[model samples]
Target: MNADAVPGLVAVLAVTVTTIAIGTWGLRFSRTTSDFFVASRTVNPRLNASAIGGEYLSAASFLGVAGLLLVGGAEMLWYPVGWTAGYLVLLVLVAAPLRRSGAYTLPDFAEARLGSTVVRSACSLLVVGVGWLYLLPQFQGAGLTLESAIGAPRWVGPLIVGVVVLVNVMSGGMRSITFVQAFQYWLKLTALLVPAMVLLVVWLDDGRPGSPSGSDGAWSVPVAGEGAIGLYTTYSLIIALFLGTMGLPHVVVRFYTNPDGRAARRTTLVVLGLLGLFYVWPPVFAALGRVYGRELVAEGHADVLVLELPRLMMSGLGGELLTGLVTAGAFAAFLSTASGLAIAVSGVITQDVTSRFVGERGPTASVAAAFRLAAVIAVSVPVLVALLSTNIGVARSVALAFAVAASTFCPLLMLGIWWRRLTDAGALAGLAAGGLGAGGAAVLNLVGVEGSGWGAALLAQPAAWSMPLAFATMVLVSLATPSRAPSHARRFLVRLHTPEVLEQAG
Candidate 1:
């Protein structure tokens, strides 16, 4: 590696070490198995909101959003807009009732609401699938960040991040996960915010240079692929991101840390503000990249634009310092979200998979041991997949994961929380439809499937149709199988709809 890259190397090392040190501090409070899974339900609103912002931003927000905008034009703004709006949808419809359900994971909610072990098991598998899907991009982005900043081999990035994440998770569980993520949120905001401000100043200093390649209108417009397919891709991406936020496994598990429904809603409200603030900067980077870093787009290395634009537009110590800062934020992006997904996936696996085989008596010992084992499995599989796969445009790959989540869990959560007529059989059928449709499309996408006309558009962006299909299948099956509704459905709905103080008054 070049000597000039030393600052980048230091920044990456410093972030990782600081993360571990903070996790060690949080580990002190994580004594029991319950503490490990949900931070013993003591996380406050601001802290939880910061943690959510940390985990929710992922590679897509850090690097992919800017890259997509630079390459695909203004149409790409939909990605960030839908992502933030999804929280509004969650806050209005799902947040409070979900917290009130008093479930540690989605499967816990499934079993509680429907009173069926069958639905719980299915939901468990879907949670693991979605977590792994989301995790792949983080690991891939880590490799990209490390390579871009300091010239480390791509594999080293994923390996180092995987190890660090495993240590954090196995050591402190949700307590450490929460602290690390909250810290990362601010780190990422500063990393992007400072550079964006400087870049804006630098752009003004340059007397507002013209587009590097000319035809600035193309890059500023809201169209990507034109015609019918283009329209489908844009709408499907919106559906996936807007509804998908409520369905992501890592995002949903955060609610379980809130002490009450009110706190859950408050956390979500704060999260929306934090996310809205952070998202405003990516487009700035994208627009600046159009002027200063156009070659990255031409070279098909757009993911590095955020890391490269600093050095491209400036010089000497100042540029190197900004590069290091973004590199640190990028690494934090991988570490925070990867760690959050680790806890989310492992929790489900421990509850449904590993815990089933844990032979020790009592809740504490068995749950802890099982969780440790599940954490290993949860982190390992995605690391392997990320290493074996080629770059699929980090943002695009994440969108596929969102498509699957939107199709499957969006329906289940919306219906399960709001519709008393929902049955386990209905949920099971809908999950199957959504999983098969979106999962099959995702698999095809990974294997390089495409063709002319509508097939390609539908396969490329399945959420628009798949989400509605899942909802319809769930509703129709639920209508036909009204007899299969949980016996306590009314009481459960009352509990969800009622405030905690009201339950006490009753």
Candidate 2:
């Protein structure tokens, strides 16, 4: 190993050890099934918000955004903006209502609202699909981080991070990870913030330098694309990022841990602030990269800018220490986010697949056992895929996950919460339409399909079209089959929309 790699390797080891230690500490609280699933639905807004920030700011936010900005320029700002604004959309529309649904998972909400096993099963499949899709990038990112930090083989990072996350999830489930994630959020923020502050001081100490000469003029443009194609791509991305948060199985699952709808709303409010604060630093790193690390952009290694910038700007002990700090944060990003996704997917699998064999009224021990088994299965598939699949831009891959979520669950959630006339038939139809559209596009992209013109643009960003198609299909199908609507729809809506105070008084 290179001498310089020692700090990074030490940082990775420290983070891994600390994560396991924290998870084991949390195991003391993870006795019952409820404790395993949703922290017994008692996480306060502040703590829950911090945990949300930890998991939600995945590899995409930590590394991909700055890299994209370094190469793609100001237009990439939309990624962070849309990501943070997503919580805003959730706060206003979905958070409180979703919490009030009294469902443990998205599939639970689907079944409760639509009163159909078929709808619930379809939702379960989608939750797993989206979870795995999102987890893919997290795993891939782990490999990239390890490769950049310590010259470890790329496969080493994914396997190590995956195993660490699995151990935590299997040990205590959501309750265990809640503490771990909450701690990681602050660590990630500090990891990025301190280095950024020091770099800014260094830049000021030197002159604030301009972009390197002969840079592409397009790099300065804030818009991602030009003309109609640019506008379409930008809007499609915005649609996905803004609406997709409510549909992300991991993100939505966090809401279930809140004590009530009111607390869920409060949690989202705090999350918005926390996310906004965290996002401010990535762009700073991108701008600094333009000055100090422009060669990384040319080398197509911009993803490592956050990890590399600290060492480049300073040398000796300080640089190595900062490198180690950011490396720790990057590993935390993979672990925390992967842990959340595992919990969400495992909950669905335990409920839908494992528990069926055990019977619905099985002992709590049986249920927890099923959850642990499902956690292993939930994480294993993604690790294998990350090992075999071709690497893509982490942020772009995550955006596709968002698009899929936007196209499928976003419609299901919005109408399911606000529209009483929605029926199982409508939900199923909308899911198929949106899922096939966006998912097909994603698959094609994954297989290295490429093209130009509007066809390529549409495939690259399907949300603008697919999301509307889903909403329209759901509405039209429901209107056509009013008799198929759930008899309990109105009652569920009442529960969802009613303030907790009113429900308590009643």
Candidate 3:
């Protein structure tokens, strides 16, 4: 009886065991801070690409995107497409240079490029904020999965994830996380792909080839807005997803693990392909969800659309077995993304906090210990937030996080890499403007100022306007206060733009 819950539990347990085992195995190679922070700068392009794909495909992509497509329709597909295409933007603009800078984290880039500890500390604060924002959904997704699959209480999933993640992140940092994420990538892809194939067969056998009734026509078409609010929300989302990837801390940190600029570029390209393949399935589930998952929608359970499909479509133990597989995949999404976020934020804290006391203390410092300590702090905030916050759709929460990242950090990274004249004063001012602008809007949204049309538009998509203001402030402020510019700006530019081999040989 109720084998649906049983098989689901088995699959979840199997995936969890595999993830922990891989992370433990990786600890053997992680000997020093360098290994923990950036994998000793030796991870090959192929495996690094897989790790990137795994970590990048967060709960938003796995569960949220599909749910959005089910609820909102074709406009939602752009989210995944934009997210993956962001790598191309990274490939052309910042991937190689960021990797070649030999910076383990974003703050390191700020300090090295601007030569200002003030700028570095500001960046550190932003990194921790964005990391925690990104992490809340991962923990929430975990809670949702356990509730649906195992009949567990609301808090159980997040608590389990928080403890497990703290253990993995503290054990080995980036070195260990790299292997864990790479393994989870294939597990996630397989988990989604297999159930999808079986579901497709079941749908065909049932002989309902046309569009689902409720989601047909208007709902299925691109830019087919239910109202003006939907239109503005869609366009704003497109902007946030397209521009936000460059600013994501965990995503940016992976570049530092590559051996050279060329490897970094290659890694981004492979990640694009892996992510592209994985994205194809979410829409499939979302579309079928429109048909088979109508009840979930009525019950306001859209995020669980992927989990509920098997039991709804197929009878007997086969459906339960398939639900188990999808359950495991969802867990992989949560674990891999959460682990990467913890590592990125913790690395920033460790580097920044210890730099205060030791001023680049020699190799003997307990930098690894600092990183482990920071990992605890990094994961703690989001867990608390997730527990306190009301449950929202996975995609919406993620988009809000993206809006925040796109507003604050995206401008900083773009200008830091390209605009040689940017000054420390300019950066700090821009960061303040963007953070306040976007953060204020997000807070309003949280408090439910979801007014219709333009009012809703303003709160929903603050980035398109806020990003420009931040960039303008940086340029104006930098021009107004050129005296604060770093003296070594030209030399830093050369090092950042040059190939890794050229820098080493020079």
lDDT of each: 0.90, 0.92, 0.84
Q: Candidates sorted by lDDT, descending order?
A: 2, 1, 3
Point out where model 3 deviates above 4 Å.
Answer: 212-231, 354-365, 500-506
Q: Is candidate 1 or candidate 3 better by lDDT?
A: 1
lDDT of 1 by residue, 255-306 (tens): 9899999999999999999999999898889888888887998899998999
Model 1 Cα displacement at 444 (Å)?
1.2
Candidate 3, clashing residue pairs? Answer: none
Error of 3 at 112 (Å): 1.1
lDDT of 2 by residue, 1-506 (tens): 79999999999999999999999999999988888889999999999999999999999999999898888877688899999999999999999999999899999999999999999999999999999999999999999999999999999988998899999999998999999999999999999999889888887887765743323554334345678888888899999999988899999999999999999999999998999899989989988888888899778899999999988888899899999999999999999999999999999999999876664555777888899889989999999999999898889899999999999999999999999999999999999999999989988887789999888889989999999999999999999999999999999999899998997799
TM-scores, all models, native as reference: 0.97, 0.97, 0.94
Candidate 3 steric clashes: 0
Model 3, C-alpha of 27: deviation from truth (Å)? 0.5
Report the Cα lDDT for residue 138, model 2. 97
Which 10 residues in a row give candidate 2 its minimum summed lDDT? Answer: 211-220
Backbone clashes under 3 angstroms, per model: 0, 0, 0
